[model samples]
Target chain A: MTEEQTRENGDAPRGKEKSEQILDAVKERRNRQRESAAAEEKTVNLVVFILDGDFYGFYGEEIKEILPYEPVTFVPGCPDDLLGIINVRGDIESVVNLHRMMGISPGEPTRDTRIVIASAEGIRSGILVDGVEDVLDVPQSEIKRPLATLDRSIREFAVGGETLYNEKYVTILDVGKIFSKIVH
Target chain B: MQTQTLFLLLFTLKGIRFGVDMEGICGMEPLSRTSEREIPIGWFHEVLSLEISRSDYQSPMVLYLQNAKSHFGVIIESPEEVNRQIDLENIRPLPKLMEQLCRISPVWGAALTSGKGEKGIVLLTDLFRWRDLSLKIESKTATVAPPAVS
Candidate 1:
């Protein structure tokens, strides 16, 4: 309405000469929308680790803990991938060798080796790995499907797809499927 | 709350220690002292499908386990007297995954032991399950026996 009223209301004095101010208003609106969209993009925490020189990960919710690898009591009569069972604090958890399960001949464990305790749907067990790399939140949309060329054993349980992080490709593991296959 | 003390007879087969309920344990005696024909004999290694050798059971002794009316003997290493009375609370149930993986082994549960010269997880086995395994072994041996007789 009046020039004084426009100034008091913080409204742009309307006219062709106000083009710069109009552009600023558009920019501010765009930034607000961008921030809200970013806030809406779902993210999930992932526990990524190294296996046979490849990066693999599990959803953070499925991973209970990671402990320094220790000697596991060799359980007889189990498949080779089933390394054995271990004493975690007071609980008895069976450990599976991911390298052997994927048909890779594993070497001796190094100092960085870890036992990842995974619990899904009340079923729990330990997964032996060469080492753990990182635990971070990854945008769910960034995860892609497991490479079609992956071995059948990996494809059998691989899920959540793969994500590129820190210059490495981290394939998400389907922990529930892993437990189901191991159980059934 | 009442605490139950689980009595187990401890032994090792190929250095892999295992335990069995002492309740069903009839006795332990030298293989030479018993009538071998009176009770069927099954080697612990053979029952467990572990690598078996003639010398694997060096100084082997017979551990008798009884069920209901019938009793049987299994060849095992000499009992390692590492505390037969285990706290029932200490026996940990096998992880559900292991329960499915340990189909052939008679392992019902396990106990994590420490100090007093006992360390690591001791596989608590069920001898009666081994007796079940023994029947399968006997049937296999019998199936092969007729060809030898003929």
Candidate 2:
């Protein structure tokens, strides 16, 4: 509020107190606006990878590490998407075949094959990828909702995607949906 | 409530990719090791009638469908991959008209698969119903078959 708005029909001491209160209120509003602008300007970090030759990405905060592919023990009766479990240090983590989950044909593991250890909502698992591309800071505006052409099943969990100037398309997956699939 | 995730074995048959539930799948064997000639005459005809070219019988891969009682083999080009775990929520059921038109349509659903610069459709098979149909074919063949030649 302006100084004129803060003026009151009162004695000098009381008017000073009212002016001081108005000043504090104005400062608070200015601080809130600055915080909101900062929040909007912040960029999102993503970890990008290739699965069955298609580019995919996950929030960088959801990833724990990127490790080379290791031998996994076959677990009977487990879902086919789960290759098996691997020993990540002292911890055993389930490795998921993202290619198969995406309905893509599985490709042979090569030198570029890597396991992405990702965690979301307290659930952690490893996803097998053809290769780890890079970590990028994508502006929020660059990300758009998935198109109508995308299957409802996949589009439900796809948090939109970003297109690079080079025309490379990257779909960002919803990590929570990725880890929440029930194992048969 | 049940978790909608399912384990499926993905394979390509007649140039189109299809997925079948892994629950009823006993295992996959190379056709060279277990030749199509070994299959009984009754079940063999049923397989041939399903539009799969007789030539495909010589394919390299054989997926065995099994329940508690018996097993039947399906000849496919190859076992492309086993999707050990897949969330059923990501699978879309075929349109009502498509299902109604193809009464024996082995595929109950489909999903989109992306590749280099293009996308393709992947059909998902209904494992339980598919096995039931196979058994029905076997039983029908047994009941209607003519006497074996001496």
lDDT of 2 by residue, A71-132 (tens): 66433224566775555654556677777667778888899999999887676788889999
Deviation in Å, model 2, residue B125 alpha carbon: 32
Off by over 4 Å in 1: A1-35, B1-3, B32-35, B101-105, B137-150
DockQ, candidate 2, vs. native dimer:
0.02
Q: Top model by lDDT, which number?
A: 1
The 0-to-1 C-alpha lDDT of every candidate, in the order given, reads: 0.78, 0.64
lDDT string for model 1 (A53-116, tens) is 8898999999999999898887777766678889988899989877766777787989999999
Q: Give DockQ per model, in order.
A: 0.61, 0.02
Clashing residue pairs in candidate 2 are A79-B84, A79-B85, A80-B83, A80-B84, A80-B85, A81-B83, A81-B84, A81-B85, A82-B85
Pairs that clash in candidate 1: A144-A161, A144-A162
